[model samples]
Target: MDKTPLTDPALAQLFTQARTYNSWSDRPVDDATVRQLYALVSAGPTTANSHPGRFVFIRSAAARARLRPHLSAGNVEKTMAAPCCVIVAYDTRFHEFMPQLFPSRDFSATFAGKDAVIADTAMRSSTLAGAYLILAARALGLDAGPMSGFDKDTLEAEFFPDGRWKANFLCNIGYGTDDQLFPRNPRLAFEQACLDL
Candidate 1:
């Protein structure tokens, strides 16, 4: 496959210029946009195409109310104010769809009986998918605030009482406001953070 580099503006939208918004505008996110965001996220690669990520978009007042108590004190106001809060979760039984996802052959048996591998792969793939969700939303002209400041155990119990899915992280998405933005933080240089073997 031949591909050209994306335009500078596109790159900026997806990375450098994109901010983690802590405040959102009053603009509402419609269901169609949410669905489109997931369509893009689902196309991202995952381990053996396990594709474990499951998303729950909390947009309605009732849903937000249900989510409130699970948030950390610092995350509550921002999350509640955002137009949508997504629960990025992983399906524990994702391997069962290996025949469909991988297609060439069934890889279900490789993970089904292995608890550790299942948990590790599910978490890894779901985290990757969650990252895709962020980038996808940005590409679609939306802002995202990825967060981890929530009570995982209780949140999972509240959202996934069936035990089939487990929460990995949370992300609030919508039209963002600069109302709560702080200065951009610095990142480690390659020499400081990576090894060139």
Candidate 2:
């Protein structure tokens, strides 16, 4: 841990005070802000810095309309109403960058031929990168609502026509409305969720 931890107010803003919002205010999130958010997120650690995560920021009405048909009934209205929804995805060919990003060992060729390893690495690293984006958003004074309640195949077909990128999840971004938040749910106790082996 750092000699001095983050201030309590900052901690609360990013963690305790944060809620997975189902309603958004009319305030818009600009392209610059989202770009800054990505820069922050990309700096987080990843396996071999594979940096597989990719994002599609759905801002236009047409894009949102296209996404709606893929979302579950419970997610459509809220997702569509948000200012933007980020499609967090992974590139199947992420290993192609290993030579550039991890030149010390330069294992790109080895990774390129291993389909199972590629799939596992892409899924795990991309999911972690998505989580980083959520934290980065809160750190930048924006709220995030991450969801996995969409038809992945439909989203990929509609958005990633080349078939190289695949959707991992979706996260809506914007200012939030308090009335839409449900009562807080309790989290597991430390002993129940952690093991100190």
Candidate 3:
């Protein structure tokens, strides 16, 4: 397969067009799209390939209704208006999957009985997966709005009380409206943000 140039007009636009969309069209995102996004994101890297992230997508009115009370007032309307909302969560027992997912050696035993290590690894790796979700959505021509404005404890109790799953963040996905976007903001230059060493 031929690779497109980095300077290709379409590729350039895709990079520039990706934005945090706060409002969406009335259109609905199909389940297949959600699955495709997961399939794409799962291929991204993780610590020891542990693949700690788990996603619970809420598209039905009933599911979204369950999420409503947990969201801050500022987030309630936009979340409801979105075609789909994804609950990006981490598994507290992600090490159990290491045998199947990592498959190189049995690393699961190393994490057993270590609560602090488990929590640290799970949150960091799952957050990376959440970032992968946003990029994958952009690649698929979808818009996303990711926020941390919701109540985590309320969310966990309402959605994941089994103690196995921990909430990371919430992202609303759909076709975005330009009217809802603010002007582009400044970003630090590479020289200012990166270190060669």
Candidate 4:
């Protein structure tokens, strides 16, 4: 039997050093890489495994143009310069897939006609998936910058006019530049941040 090397202190640093990168090198992130990241992220857990998140990767100048007007001033330069910017969205009608996804029972009917509940569930689940995308990207040796500074209404209208997809967040992915990093910030110790019941 082939045994894999056990995870240890050095492996922990790989996760610890993963930070939100704001600047990227001129290198490009190809479509294949983006698809691979999605394939990895989709396997992460969600409530009932609903898998509501949908990603729209904008790599061309034209698609990036549609995003510019909605971006916050601070996010414009870095986001535009990145090789690919992913629009993480949630499907409002995701419950329709519950029968195929969850399988035990048909749960679609519970949310089919309830707009508020549907929106709430979809947004929460998709946000969790988006976080998974960031972590998966890091594990794959890619730098990620996840931001929430865009205008959601304008983004939805411009990118998903049919009302099926609602914008959640944006993530810029590529090779990062050392010149763009700020000094590492301090983190709370376990005793200060967590409490045992």
Measured by lDDT, the strongest candidate is 1
The full ranking of all candidates by TM-score, starting with the best, is: 1, 2, 3, 4
Candidate that beats the other on TM-score, 1 or 3, i.e. the better one: 1
**Clash pairs for candidate 2:** none
Model 3 residue-pair collision total: 0
Candidate with the larger lDDT of 1 and 2:
1
For model 4, the stretches where C-alpha displacement exceeds 4 angstroms are: 1-14
Relative to the unseen true structure, what is the C-alpha lDDT of residue 184 in candidate 2, on a scale of 0 to 100? Answer: 85
List CA RMSD, all candidates: 1.0, 1.5, 1.7, 2.4
Per-residue lDDT of 56-82 in model 2, one digit per residue for the tens? 999999999899999999998899889
Model 4 C-alpha lDDT per residue in residues 1-197, reported as the tens digit of each score: 99886477435534667778889998988878888999988899987888889999999999999999999999999999998899999998888889889898878667878988888889999999999888777777788899999999999999999999989999998888877888879999999999999
Overall local distance difference test of candidate 2: 0.92
lDDT string for model 3 (41-65, tens) is 8999999998899999999999999
TM-score, structure 3 vs. true: 0.93
Candidate 4 lands at a TM-score of 0.90
Error of 3 at 133 (Å): 0.5
lDDT of 4: 0.88
Best-performing candidate as measured by TM-score: 1
Q: lDDT of model 2 at residue 40?
A: 95
Candidate 3, position 4, lDDT = 60
Worst 10 residues of 2 by lDDT: 103-112
Off by over 4 Å in 3: 1-7, 10-14
